[model samples]
Target: MNKRLVVLLGMSLVSSAAFAQSSVTLYGIIDDGLTWTSNQGGKSAVQMQGSISQGNRWGLKGAEDLGGGTSAIFRLENGFNVNTGTLSQGGRLFGRLAYVGLSNDHYGTFTLGRQGEAVGDYIGALSANGTLPGGILFPHPGDLDNNGIDFRLNNAVKYVSPTIAGLTGVAMYSFGGVPGDFNKNSAKSFALQYVGGSLQLVGAYTSIDHPATAVPEGVWTPNNTVNGNYGLAASSYKVLALAAAYTIGSARFTADWTHTQFGGLDPTLGAKINGHVTFNIAELVASYMVTPTLQLGAAYSYTQGNVSATGKSPHYNEVDASVDYLLSRATDVYASATYMRAGGGAVADLAPVLSPSSSQNQLALRLGIRKRF
Candidate 1:
């Protein structure tokens, strides 16, 4: 009887060990709010927006312990509109993040699938505009610099090093997935960051070999001029950014600078359709915690766009402020406002009004609540 009991106990231990090796979790956030925008085509409009302070998302992440300090992991996250109950990120089911990889405590992690670039990962941490408050309105024109743009690259591989002495590094690559011309859609990025005490610093760079083309106005025709065989080498987009932040007590300050360049388009297209453009952006932000549950934040941004082919130089200045009140650990409410003024050549002519042109102004206000579970 004693021998039989020992054998059964050993079997139970083995089964429990196996169960501990693998686990999965489900998590998500829902954010919906009302917003009012003035000068949305010369008229003020009120609309419901999702993910105002944070992008509404649901995700599944899992890990398997392989023993000896090594593990396998994967994540699939999707963005959606809390107001309309629709998929965001260009209608992709897993538009935010989808990847699988392995990790070790002493080593690092390597993942492959749709993922964010290195620059976006590092620079995004430096700005309240990137994290809360301003949202997409504070991004540089076209989000060319990705300082809070949250642009995701499809068919990509990423690597993140374990933190060493308060420092971490990342590298990423994207495959265009285009057949017959593999290099045309390829992109590469690198970033390094350091965090110690109250200080943080980050630097990053990225390059694209062949970027996807954008459709022209009122026309469904393919505008592959940027990547088509007839256009320039198609690999002409580049970006670099530096950012730093310091925290003292309940107050924090941040500063960031970024530069971006785009080139190589089909000459047959109009001036707005082709040629080279450069954008430079700088911003300063500050935030103070009134209490654990209440905080106030503000920011100012300046952006300049220079066009090589069109002789246009436009500039934009913006101011943003917000107050957030935490209702509970899982829920919060906030009100924010942004005012922007644009000046320079033909800025008034750009459609969608998200790009550089002459004489453009906008004002926006949002009040909403968010809950996470």
Candidate 2:
């Protein structure tokens, strides 16, 4: 019975049977930067962008308790690419999240397998590519509506609740285990949140089916079209979101809104017509904390799209800023800038996940650093 002594005898039988309620942890984050792309292919470069602001990861989380208050949780996250170290959401090996659940601080929580949704968890952290210096080059233009940060979901099932009096709720479903194709690459989502006091609110909804055959598993084939991968390859994809935030004293204010839909549409991948395609987005963000280690942020986003049988519309407008600082308590340092414009007169192309900008305006700048554990 080897194999590292059967994993150290199963970790000493789980540390003597939850020796004082279990817990396991190991976390990570490491970001890098040195960007400046005012047109990479068209010339104007300065690379070394790894994990934009957050993306490189590491994980293993656990919980046990299982007593009156309930507990039994698990997580396994991993997403990498700290500049060539390799692996990142499209590379699996615990591509960002993997779950197992049971939680109850008065009844709530239930999970199982790959997650993240509910508008990137209750309104994508008030937007700005889901917070923290707007990483991944700031989405919107093809983030379609993951509201907070790019994709995730695979054969799932989730629920969250508990936080009454200030509200909270969530739900999810995912599956496309394929095999007779029950809704091809299925997915679903729902969310709601509120937090009184300094005020905060959220709302969410999502849908996906055949999102390029539902990504997952090293993400690379099929392409998940709709703009970057080239439009018109949607058999379904939907999203909706609403958000709000407030705080006075060191400042904070936010607003987010989203709407996306792209059903049917497969005009062989590039169409002048064939059906459905819609998008709408709005965002406003702000952050301030002059001292206390510095901090500053700003954002503005707007997107609009349409093609319902070719009424033709394409839009863009983005703005960003950041100044972060705080080189302690987990470290950080930043500087950012982003800009986009592509108003009217567009047959399609705003990309936004980088690349694209032969002229409707595009600019980016960054100076970054990060570390966490």
Candidate 3:
């Protein structure tokens, strides 16, 4: 070969080697199903739904080796409705999750952008709401605790600690980015997790200020006007939760508790807010592996809301069950149902997941299939 050709070939080899350090992947899941509601707007109906078993999504994720045992990473995930081919999460293309950050094997992971809070990440995984079979309707009323992945924060900074002696720690904050006020719509969250043998535990806290001002990101305002019975906005919102799980052979048991407080509020949809609101929710869930390809799950949740503003203390109780048969490692067929009863509460909304029922009781059922790629 000529001298010039030899030099060009040598450069190509070097460039190819450098490119090997960076990798990208395209991934996604599709869940489609049909749902039957015993009561919807005082009318029973059957509807086609997407993401019933799991949210439909597609994304690009990549990692670039930066040396020193640290790497730069990015993820862009989207949510959509497979039934109608429409975008979920208010038309945002990459609404499910989007983030970029650095990862260190010995240190931890830190990322920035729109993402899930610590409660749903560290604690939710141990509950039925985060599982394949029970996720559709497993959340407490209104998904108040986000155990079912109802919301994500915008302009967020998140950090996760490396596991040490069966323990891991997490911290995160989301800046509202308002010009004159840094706390206008800011949010803060923290969590600690422990895993030992067949037992797991998690504790988490999240607080938000002026939740209504950041509506576009799907952050649930105290009143939840986006899709709730009463549109109330709170100046402050906070949630504290604890969860635990234990495994015995093929069966797992989980229990969780959450307390939420809403301070100072304005009504955007319903009666004027005259006082504050507090929510206490408790849940128990169970899952079992009947066989290598079959799994069964069940859950029960009780949520009581003390609406001090109106002295209308309402309570909701729910039960859910599901079964999934794996067609393959990455695919499954599933069915589930949720039944709920309400008393001393006029609001019967299932916001962030489904619409409110016209009556005090509601039953929803679904049959679906899911595939991951």
Candidate 4:
């Protein structure tokens, strides 16, 4: 009996050691705010907004070591609204991210499921609107170029290369999942990034077929557009963007440019135009760390638009300013102000705000708190 007891105790120790090779974690963020708009459908108003600085979310992630410098990894992330307790991203349980993949030290990581495009992964890091201190209000008009990741791709297969000499590359493809048509609603994206010392650079490109059909709940949807009543129904959508950031002392500066196109529009399908439309946007951002727990940021952007069929051109200009104070490592308070002006008969609009201004100018102010765990 004594010998058998010793063997069983040894087996239990080995089992526990093996189990330590796998691990899982839960994490989330909650952000809520109050916003005052100078013009929302011709009236100045104040409202409660949730997830202004960061989207409210909870996520589970795990990894299992498989030996030989490889591991199996998975993540499931869900987005929700703090104000209404409703799910975000079209109400999908794990709409923000749902993926499983394998990571190898020597090779690269490969993943499959619904995921973000290369633009959001690579170039987004260097864009002001992609991160805190700038927040959602800093994005270009309509978020048309996806600098802040307005939508994600479904049925995607993604590859991320291991960093080599401070450079990394990423690619992704999303299948349309339409039984007979392979290209319909499909998407392809690529990105390259380099980070070294105080300077960072990135470039990304993405093309999607049938924007409205590919992402029904995304930016092209009627309710998702800047103005709730309008939608863009195009045969294809494309974006190309480049960005660079430099840090000096307690200050950082970023500059980025993006080009977006909506091609082959059908006027009968809720599209206002019979032909394509394109936009070119450029932005500059600067941020300064005033103290260990305080920061200030500002940005300016310009957008140019052209309609292929009407020979019409329009332009827009926007400015964003923000301040952040850290209450603790896991909590912070922030304030932001944004203003936009439109020219050439274009209406002033901002993303995530369902209404367009009655005039060609708009302004908004927000105060918010964010907590991460």
Note the Cα lDDT for every prediction shown. Answer: 0.72, 0.76, 0.80, 0.84
Clashes of 1: 5
lDDT of 3 by residue, 1-373 (tens): 6999999999999888868999999999998888888877778878887776678999999998888989999999999989789998889889988999999989999999988888777667766677646575667777666677767888999999999999999999999889998788899999999999999999999888876665434334444632234445667778899999999999989998999876776655232564577889888888899999999988888888887756777788888889999999999999998888887845455434566688788888889889999
Question: What ranges in model 3 sit over 4 Å off?
Answer: 1-14, 215-230, 268-271, 347-351
Superior candidate under TM-score, 3 versus 4: 4
Which 10-residue window in model 4 sums to the lowest lDDT? 222-231
Instruction: lDDT for model 4, please.
Output: 0.84
The TM-score values for the models, in the order shown, are 0.88, 0.33, 0.92, 0.95
Ranking by lDDT: 4, 3, 2, 1
Index of the highest-TM-score prediction? 4
lDDT per residue for candidate 2 within 1-373, as digits (tens), equals: 6899999999999889877688899998888879877764466677787677777799999989978999999999998887688787667788879899999999898999989888876777778766757565776665667653667887789989899999988988898888997888888888889899999898889887767667533111244343332354567778888999998999988888888877777656433346787888898888899998888888888888877765767788888888989989888889988877765554222333466655667788889898999
List candidate 2 segments past 4 Å from native.
1-23, 26-60, 63-73, 76-98, 101-112, 116-132, 145-151, 157-181, 184-207, 210-235, 238-261, 265-274, 278-308, 311-322, 329-338, 345-373
CA displacement after TM-score superposition, residue 368 of candidate 2 (Å): 14
Report the poorest 10 consecutive residues by lDDT, candidate 1. 215-224
**lDDT, candidate 4, 178-237, per-residue tens:** 989999999999998899999999999999999888977656654433322334678889
